[model samples]
Target chain A: MTPRRILLGAAGAVVVVGVLEAVSRSGLVDETSLPPASTVLKEAGKLAVDREFLVDVGATVREWLLGLLLAVLAAVPLGVLLGSVPLLGTASRALVELCRPVPSVALIPLATLLFSSPAQTNMSLIFYACLWPILVNTLYALRDVDPVAKDTLRAFGSSTPAVLWRVSLPSAAPFIATGVRIAASVALVVLISTELLVGGDNGIGIYLTETQQGGGRTDLMLAGACWAGVLGLLANTALIALERVAFRWHAARVEGIA
Target chain B: MLEISGLGHAYGTHRVLEGIDLKVGEGELVTIVGPSGCGKSTLLRCIAGLVPPTEGKVVLKGAPIDGVPDDLAVVFQDYSRSLLPWLTVRDNVALPLRRRGLGKAERRAQAVKALASVGLEDAAGKYPWQLSGGMQQRVSIARALAYKPTLMLMDEPFGSVDAQTREDLEDLVLQVHRAEGMTILLVTHDIDESVYLGDRVVVLARNPGRVRDELPVTLPAGRDQIGTRADAEFVRLRAEVGRLVRGVVKDSEPPDATDAEDADAEAVATAVEEPAKK
Candidate 1:
């Protein structure tokens, strides 16, 4: 991006923040109930200084990462199997459709009752939320692989595994990356939501609930929300960077298509 | 040598090829030309081992080909999908060599050599989508050349390209054939292209894809696009091949009517000359 574009984006962000600040300060709404940008920023600064906030962030990050890794381990191979074979894909579609629409958050109550531990419950919810995108994306990507490329590999006397590795996997990689990126933000949201719902040991969500209940410190609560937003932004940006670095060809092709 | 006899295929009761027979000698270029939807591609697929013959078999070097053979390579019509987009041009050319256990340096060297053969050496690091349609097809051809197969099958490889690029690719194929000394079987719907490229052009009739006729191209050994097309013999062969392809005969009868008309025409002409002399 050009520096001019960057400056324009920054200007746009500032204008939005300025308008929000003006609305909150004009008494159109209760400032205490919905804190202004300035108050939230100040609280954010204090939270950054607090070591407890760092620990809570660490716990959420650990759970999110562990859950994401587990989802990948379980989803990728299964997705490939479902994608490669037509008959199996047809047989499994019913089961996938059955499980896909039931939101992961809806499973939180059952997860809490089953797993006596808060961390396990949170991890389970994250896994549940993250698996579908990864699995579905991978399956679609594999299915989208060019049949001509597969036939070319087959013409070279390549085995089934060889065709999958050399043609299907590489072709499907961009879609898989897209899925993972989506799942990253979703996993984080589910992780924090699970903690907030189930009353975790120490998480940003628990801290927000505590702050709200004690003195109705809306700024502090908003500060925790701000951190969640920042985490989500950071995760998305990181995945975008990884995608650009790893699949430059795919990115260039996408830009061309666009 | 490759021999295919009694080759028949069908897709869920819609028979495409039936009782088709073809024999290709070593280092010969045989082009199969037919009308659209005549199952020429199906015949090529059966030969390439990508599609199985429902009844007969394709024998390669005296062995029945049940699947794709190691010594055969195919260039598909859709060049965009034939080459893997995720790989660079050089890597795409070098892909078939990966399982051969060639070292990285050797693979790159061979890929570069192959690209140079197709006049695409500068495009080694570029992705397939980075090149034009012609260049991408060249990359696919480079890949086929790099594989160095004993036999190469091309299914309307130039159909998707522009006219100018089509001519250029045709000449490149001729050059590659000269250099590689590999037998090639090309399937095309373009009658002139089949005559121009093949040592012997095979015409396939529609509605079961039986062999219509086989025309021997007796053009001079060396050929250029302009000079070859301008030659009298080339024109005559082209017309003859075109007539055969369109199912046109001098007798104004169906092709299966046989050569009895030719003998009858000769007898009538002799009788007319005798009357003129009297």
Candidate 2:
């Protein structure tokens, strides 16, 4: 990215915020419903130093990270197995197709009733949401592994496990990384949604629920949502940067394709 | 030494190669040349045990090869796909050295030597994708060299590079073949390449791929691209291999169509389930 691009991005963000601030201040809408951007930003600043808010942020991040990690652990190996074995892949295709589209957010009530702990409920929902992207990406990436690389390894008398470890894994890694980045955002959304519905004690969603319950403090509610959005944005940016650095060759190849 | 006896292959109704028999001596470089889609690659795969021929068996030393032998290596033409893009050139070259029980330091040491042999010593740290197409192919060849296989198979290894790089790579293979005394079987569609690189050139006919003719190269060892190609004998041999590969010898050849059909029938008489695709 160039300095000029960064400058323009900053300017664009300021313009949006200015528009929101102006629209709110103009009294075109009731202040109680859509709090002025300045007032929300002021509350958000206080949130940066508030110990309780910090704990909420930490809890949200922890749940998101844990759920994503578990999903990746379960999905990647299972994806590789199904991807490599034609029989297993064919066997499970119907089941996967049926289960995949049922939204994890819709499962919140079921998960809340089934799991005793709030963490368990949050984790279950987040895990459900994060699994599909990672699994499908891993599966397709493994299938798309270069045949020549596999053949070259085989010609040297390398075993099946050797070829998988050396060729298939490396070839699939960039795709896997992209999947994880997508899963990270999905996990955050699911985590927050689960907490909001289940009424957790320490998460951004909990902060929103509590603020709304405490005589409808609309400023605090908007501020909490702002922090959550910022967190997602920062995470996505970092993950994108990491992908670029870790898989430069894959990045170059993708650019060439585009 | 390698012996292939009456080998035939088919994918359902699609017969790729049929009734092929050839013998290769130890430490000899043989090149197979023919038109496109002649199944020359399939023959190489069969010899390497990467793909099993439907009929007969390939015998390496005294044992019939049921799987790829430990003393075999292959250099494929599509270097962009053959070499792992994530690994450094040194690691790519050293990859086959694993399962040999060599320590990391030893593998790198051998890989460095192989890279130097191909004039890629300075590129050891770069990824295969970072190199030119020709340099990437050299990395593939360097990898095969580092494996130190008793037999090496190359499938049009220079096909995708520029002409100058192709010549350089051809020389690199010849240099390695002579230095290591490894038996090499190269498949090509280029007639001049077959005459230039092989100790003997085997021309194959398309459609039911089978050897049409074989000619021993009498050019002196240590050939150069300029000198050996200009040799009168080289000119004659290339033209001969070219004519044979182009199906020009079909008429003058003895009428063996019935014999070929009989052989094909016997080979497919006990047909069984098709083997899994490699």
Candidate 3:
């Protein structure tokens, strides 16, 4: 990241906090319902020291990571299969269309009923939400592979599998990385939301619910929400870093095109 | 040695190649030239076994090729896509060696040697896209040379390059062909190129593509871009090839009296003619 970008980002953060602090201190919409920036930060610091709160954070992170890995492992091969075989892609389009729009969050209630365990329920929803983006992106990326590249391999007497490994996968990697990045943030949102809806044993959303139930600790509740926001931001940043490292060629290509 | 007889191809209802016959002798450099859309690429594709011919077989060393052969390599026109961008230049050149079960060190050594032959030893660590267009095409050629194929196919390998680069690449190819003694079949739309690089230039007509004529090039063995172009024989051969390629013959009579004989006679005559002596 550049110094200029850091300065701009800091400025944006200050403005957001300043506006929230003004609203809270100005007696607009009840300060009790919405805590000020300073109060939220203080409570956030206090929560950081709480062992129970840390446990909740750990549970949420574990579910999110595990669910994401499962989704990736399942989706990538299937996506590659569909992408390579045109007939299969055409046949599966109807099924994909039907399933893609069915919200993963909407399935949370059904998952809750079926799993009989809060952790499983949250994991299942995270898997459901994250699967389609990775799968669809993989499919599109493979489809978008340069025909010239495939032909080059074919002309070289490469077997079909060799063509897939050498030409298809490398060409489609950046797109797959993009899909994974999108899924990261989405998986986090789904994990926390499922925990909030289905009442996990320990998670960020469950922690927020406990804080709210205690009453008059609006500051603590806001602080927990702030942590979730921070986690989401961090996930995006981490993925961006990973993308840069994993795909220097792709970045060069993007720079050349620009 | 390679031979193609009555080779014809079509895409659905449209015919691309018809009644095409060609022969490449051992250590021969045969260049195919025609106008755009004359199925020059289709001919190479058929010969390379990338696409099956609808009506004929491509026999290499008396064996018909049903698919890509073990001892063959191709250099496609689009250098950017021809190379695996993810692989380093050395790895790209070394890929064919993988099938031969060579160890990693041997493959790397051979790849480096091939790159050096193309004057690209410094670019071994670079990706294909990282190099200039000319350099990328050199890498493509290096890859083909690295394979050590008995027969090499090039499809307008210099078409995407600038004129100076094109001349340089043509010279590099001629040098490699001489050093390696590899039989090369280069397909191009450039009349001067076809005459300049080939021992024999095969011309094709459009629509249902067929061999219009195969003109023998009678330029000196030692060729330099400027000196060769200025040579009387080179100028005549270029003009003859250009006219034949454009289907512009002043007389309907065949240029060579020997062409009146059987197909085999024509093939033998071309195989025997030293195009450089006229």
The 10-residue segment of model 1 chain A with minimum total lDDT is: A206-215
Q: Please list the residue runs of candidate 3 whose C-alpha ends up more than 4 Å from where it truly belongs after superposition.
A: A214-216, B248-278
Looking at candidate 2, what is the lDDT of residue B229? 88
| lDDT digits (tens) for residues B94-139 of candidate 1 | 9898766799889889999999999999999998999999999999
| Candidate 1 local lDDT, A191-237, one digit each (tens) | 88778889977888788778878578988988989999999999998
Better of 1 and 3 by TM-score: 3
lDDT of 3 by residue, A122-183 (tens): 88888888889999999999999987778777777889999899889988988998998898
lDDT of 2 by residue, A1-258 (tens): 999999999999899889989999899999899888899999999999999999999999998889899999999999999999989998988988888898998898899889999988999888988899999999899999988789889998899998999999988999999999999998888888888888867999999898988579999999999999999999999999998998898887777669
Model 3, global lDDT: 0.85
**Per-candidate RMSD, Å:** 8.7, 6.6, 6.9
Least well predicted 10-residue stretch by lDDT in candidate 3 chain A: A208-217
The TM-score each candidate achieves on chain A is: 0.97, 0.96, 0.97
Screening candidate 1 with a backbone cut-off below 3 angstroms (N, C-alpha, C), the clashing residue pairs are none
lDDT of 2: 0.86
How do the residues B1-278 of candidate 3 rate in per-residue lDDT, one tens digit apiece?
A: 89999999887767778989899999989999875566777788899898899997899998999998878888987788778877899999998788778999999999999999999999999998899999999999998998898999998787777778989999998999899999999987777888889999999876667899988877767789999988899888887887776563336634432211122212322342333223
- Rank by DockQ, descending? 2, 3, 1
lDDT of every model, 2 decimals: 0.84, 0.86, 0.85
Tell the DockQ for candidate 2.
Answer: 0.66
